[model samples]
Target: MPYTTAPVLPPGTLSRSPQPVLPTGDGLVLRPWRGRDVAAVHEAFQDPLMHQWHIRRSDSEAEVAGWIEGWEKEWEGERDAQWAVVDADSDRLLGRVALRSIHLVDGLAKVAYWTTAAARGQGVATRATATLTRWAFEEIGFHRLELLHAVANEPSCRVAEKAGFALEGVKRSAALHQDGWHDMHLHGRVRGD
Candidate 1:
């Protein structure tokens, strides 16, 4: 059979033009990172859970600044979208939610998120995930979205589930974290799923 390429973006749909803010309608907002956010990023990375799952945490202001700059470049390149999850009123950085490893030709992307220690139990991650999921499916024209986390990280599992990502099973020793090889739980959601 002759090959027919699938159209990733719906007819007339365009690539995301970076937005300044995405309000989640309950006091939560997703916005692009700013230079002034370095301090909050440093503080959030101090959480033990953050260090365990994410091994590339910045230990110095310079590193975090570089990280933020990288995110900006990623946005400009249309490869990823990284947002700082913040409180609407105080504008305090609660965490981050991102769409990574975007495959525009396949209309797919992976979701990743984390919350500060103070925001952990308050459903920050869940809310951010849900909000991002909606935007990716609706605005970005992604046909499918996925979330993956270490199997040992129960909190992340909860966040994925609450955001309507169905558990898709596990990949044994799929990720190399700070503690070494780790089994990963894969969860997914498709448009209208």
Candidate 2:
């Protein structure tokens, strides 16, 4: 069976950010994930909800190290970028955000994020999502940004909506969760440029 593809942004339309930005809002700082963030990332992944919804591998120190290394490689290759969410004052990592699955040829990218359990409902994810989306569209010149969430993840859907992403639709049986085939919601925002 053939799959339908989402609309792509124009070629050579999106550009990379000239420099790393430290976006701050709502007392949170969104900046590049660093090696020092490994412990925080590991701790955040320990949350049951995080493990249930997003964790695909065992949350070991080695795994966290490898994950940080992977982000470094992506940054070096200019294929993708990730950021660690932290308290603006203390610089304590609250979570992570990333623009992954980047398609420079298509001027499109997807945003993925998660916050520590303690940080939920405090607008951390919402603010981070909005800030990152704006940076992706304006600074990076990405014309299209997409976000996907399992149908059961209501909080995630809320975050996407709050970030100005329109609900494109659902892909039936688009994801296979531990329970079974599950529907996934696709949300997107197109740059005015």
Cα-based RMSD of the predictions, in order?
A: 2.3, 4.4
Candidate 1 collision pairs = none
Model 1, position 185: C-alpha lDDT score: 99
Best by TM-score: 1
Model 2, TM vs. native: 0.87
Give the lDDT of residue 105 in candidate 1. Answer: 73
Model 1's TM-score against the true structure: 0.93
Off by over 4 Å in 1: 1-3, 10-16
Give me the runs in candidate 2 sitting further than 4 Å from their true place: 1-19
lDDT, candidate 1, 1-193, per-residue tens: 6338976864333334545578999889999889999999988887787889886777888889999988877776666779999999999999999999877778888999988888879988899999999988887779999999999999899999999999999999999987899999999999999
Worst 10-residue stretch by lDDT in candidate 2?
Answer: 10-19
My TM-score estimates for the predictions, one after another, are 0.93, 0.87
Local error of candidate 1 at 16, Å? Answer: 6.0
Model 2, residue 51: displacement in angstroms? 2.0
Tell me the whole-model lDDT of each prediction, alpha carbons only: 0.87, 0.79
